[model samples]
Target: MQFIDLKAQYDQIERDVNERIHAVLQHGQYINGPEVRELENRLAEFVGTAHCIGAASGTGALLMAMMALGISAGDEVITSPFSFVATAETIALLGAVPVFVDIEPDTCNIDPGLIEAAITDKTKAIMAVSLFGQCADFDAINAVARRHGLPVIEDAAQSFGATYKGNPSCGLSTIGCTSFFPSKPLGCYGDGGACFTSDEILATRMREIREHGQDRRYHHPRLGINGRLDSIQAAVLLAKLPLFPHEIEKRRTIGRQYTEALAHDRIIPPVVRPHNTSVYAQLTIRVDDRDALQEALKQQDIPTAVYYPVSLHHQPVFLRPDAHLPVSDEVAAHVLSLPMHPYLSDEQIRRVTTAVLEAV
Candidate 1:
């Protein structure tokens, strides 16, 4: 079975997608079109944020947030080592050091308890990732940030539809950034992403940052990048927005089914927080012999993927011999993501689950 059934999802929305694309083509406003603003407004309302700034990609969103926050050389952004490299890469790209933190073994999200110890005079902000579609403990992380008078950037790339304490993922921190990559919970047809915030100034700054720091056309006030999301992508996302709530429910249902079916197996299903609901961006599990299990599943014609095979601290590019993150390292060696998406059929899920159980 496919790891993520994008084909199935596209089939469901084909007519709408085609219509939206046609409209964009007819308008010929490829850059900063009305559709872009429409998408931004819809996303802001969906996430309960005051503003949403569409960006080129999730990485662009993160980079724009950092630009707006003025993260620069000598500044330190504390983040987990277990997340996709983009989480740490964006910080390093800005000449800021990404101070590594361990993750909670169950959630695979940054450990808030380990954050304070890593904070120092240069600590400017906390970049907390919402891993595996479950938000990190924002309450704890925010508390720590508040004590230090630092802003918190929630990397909601994998948890856009997720919730924490009844609040949405992108609305949990000072600035929340999410991806619309095809595999994300609320994906567009292609690369797209957004940044959310309640503060008007920060929102304005982010908008400018996304457009090469232009206050007005041709007016450059600060250094920035070409991070604006294309109008066509915005149109596609707008078409997909109406179906997001239903998709979230379907994903949750599928996740529950997988958990129930695999509970007794040798592999461990993903853990959900008491006050949260994961959108199941990737219904990942921990296995004793991960590589062997993956091979066995492959032999059965079931596809599985490793979210990360190496911790950021262990990666050659960011390797720091002095840094140690045991939890992240352990998770890196054991976690495996199975087929996940709202469109996954019952038969498909059962087949994949059976293959996993048999492999174990």
Candidate 2:
């Protein structure tokens, strides 16, 4: 009944992961090692991007991407209010404002239709999050950004293995960032992430930004952070990469089963729009009595989590008394994430779903 069975996944790939970690230990180049570059290259190829820059965490990836794009003070980055704080925190950390936008009621992703209205002269970028492992409508979001002459950054932290219109998640925008936190679809043993892009200049800048802005050893060109991914984490990702495609398939199948079993008048299963594929980073559902349902499931020893209990605009640090994001607020109050992982067994799925149905 694990929320995310990282242990089961590790057990399947333990030998390979151990070997990779051992190689890193023997090399003694913990930071910016050969394994790091190897992982970057492999990730870029998988995502169909020309370059991938490994980062210390998903938050680090977002920071590096924004720094590379020159997102500085007094700027505004339009984003969904329903996502994790990292989405807005990254912008505010740069002395920028995060313009709040509502999300689609069904998908819980940023509503592309609401994006244009939020833009202003200070708007520097449009950052759309792919929530619950399904990509936002990039085609429409990109079109709106193009019209406004604003760069679009896809916050694909939850949707790394997802697809939109036959294109990969991280390669579908000016800059796409994803997390490799242990719970992510393509995660390592610890905190890790990457930024993907075909633009050589942006790629170079991000690489530099992740390593204290040094063009060459000791040649400082710009301000940056110590955001590089470690060699051991890179090694873990390399060992897991070959098996990821199959894992994605298993996730998809499990998601389908959940959708089928959880169908009821009171339960609202997540919707996967046509022409898009979700990695099911979390199989979230909506219910009117979320807290009561969660408690009931807990009584039955079923684990459940709230992806977000409050929208970004409602957070104390980023509170906006005037913001009007009803859908984001509503979704935040009702959403509950069930146990989800590729390694979940049919019996486990049935047990979880049965509890959910009875609780609801």
Candidate 3:
């Protein structure tokens, strides 16, 4: 069985996708075509935000948010180490320091309690990653940020359709960034991403930053990058957007099946918060011997992956051994993501679960 089954998803939306692409081709305005603006408008409405600015990639979206927020050298952005490197990479790219914070062992999201201690005069923002398709504790994170007068940017790359306390993931923070990497919960045919904001001024700034700091043609207001998302990708995403709610429901059903079947096994299924719903971007689990279990599953033709084998603080590129975050370290050694997607069949899930149970 395929890991994500993008082919099945494509088949479901083939007609709509073809129509959208045909229109884009006919228009021939492939750069920042009309489809781009349409997608931004639809996504902004879906996320309950005032604005959405599509970017080249999720990493580019984060970089644009940082630039719009005026993060610079010597500034510190607090975030968890138990996330994709882009969470911290964007901060460092701006010559700013990423203050590593420990995550909650259950949710694997940044611990808000640890955030206050990390704040200083240089703390400009809180970059909270909604890891593994679950939203972080935005209420608590926002409380801390409000106390410190810092903006919170939600890295909702994996949790686009996820909900926390009835609010959408991207609408829960000062600024929310999500990716359209093909494997994400809501994705396009190619690399694409968007930044969302309720603040009009910040939204205006993000729009300018996304197009090389230009408020209009030949006018450069500030330093920015070519972060615009392509029209073809926008068209692909627009076609996919209409079916996203149904896909999220399918993913939830599959996740529930995995949780019920694997709960008593040697592996631990992903944890869900009381008021939160995960999109199950990765149906991850923890095992005693991750490597051994992975091998055993592979022998059965069941694929598995490790969200991260090494924490950002421990990466050779960072090389900061003194930065100790215990939860991230422990999780890196134990966490493994199983085959997950809306297209996973009941039989495939059963087979994968059976293999996992036997292996452990």
Candidate 4:
């Protein structure tokens, strides 16, 4: 079976997607075309945020947010160790230190209780990653950020379609960044991303940051990168946005089925927060013998992946000599991701769950 059945999803929306692409091609405004603004507007409405700025990739979105916040050398950004490298990579790329806190063993998200201890005078922002498409406890994290007078950036790359209480994922913090990589829940055909914010100043800053720090054509105001999303990708996302809500519901339904099917197994299913809905971006689970389980699942023709095999603290490039996160270390060793997508059928889910249960 396919890990993420993008082909099946395309089969349903091919006509609309093709029409949108044709329009973009005819207009020839490949850079900042009308479709790019249209997508930004649609995403802003969906995220319940005042503004959204298109980016080249999720990493670009995070980089722009850091720049907008004025994070500089000797600055520190508190974040979870247990996430995709982009979460911490963006911080380090800005000449700032990524102060990683341990994760909650269940959700694999940054443990908010441990965040305060990691902060210091150098702490510029609290970057909380929404791992496995479920948002971290933003209320608790935001309370801590408020007490410390620090801004919070929600790394909503995986949780774009998710909701925390009644608020959307990208609207839960001072700045929200999400990826539109092909594998993400609200993905486009290629690399694309966005930054969401209610603050007009920050929004304006990000818009400039995405375009080489230009206030207007050739008016360079500050250092920035070529991070704008292309019009073709914007067209693809615009076409997909209409069906995103239904797809999110389908993922939840499949997640429930996977949970029920493996209820009696030794493997541990995902623990979604009471106030949040996951988009099941990875459908990760824990097992005692993850390596063996992965091999066995392969034998059963069920594709499995490892979302994160190493903690940020343990990465050779971004190594920290002093800090040690036990939960991040432990979870990294055991986590495995099953094939997940809205297009997955009941029979496909049963096949996946059955293989995983037997393997574990």
Predicted model with the maximum lDDT: 2
Worst 10 residues of 1 by lDDT: 260-269
Local accuracy of candidate 4 as per-residue lDDT tens digits, 1-360: 899999999998999999999999999999999999999998999989999999999999999999999998999999988888898889989999999899998999999999999889999999999989899999999999999999999999999999999789999999999999999999998899999999999999999988899999999898899999999999999999888999999999988888778786578899887888999999988888999999998888888899899888889988887877898899999999999999998888888887776666
Off by over 4 Å in 4: none
- Candidate 2, 1-360: lDDT as tens digits: 899999999888999999999998998999889999999999899899999999999999999999999999999999999999999999999999999999999999999999998899999999999999999999999999999999999999999999999899999999999999999999988999999999999999998888899999999798899999999999999999988999999999999999999999999998999899999999999999999999999998888999999999999999999998999889888999999999999999999999999888
Give the TM-score of each candidate: 0.98, 0.99, 0.99, 0.99
Q: Candidate 2 — number of clashing residue pairs?
A: 0
Q: Give the TM-score of candidate 2.
A: 0.99
Clashes of 1: 0
Root-mean-square deviation of every model: 0.9, 0.7, 0.8, 0.9
- Deviation in Å, model 2, residue 73 alpha carbon: 0.5
**Cα lDDT tens digits for candidate 3, 303-345:** 8889989998987766578887998899899999999999888
Name the candidate, 2 or 3, with the larger lDDT value: 2
Candidate 3 CA-lDDT value: 0.93
Clashing pairs in 3: none
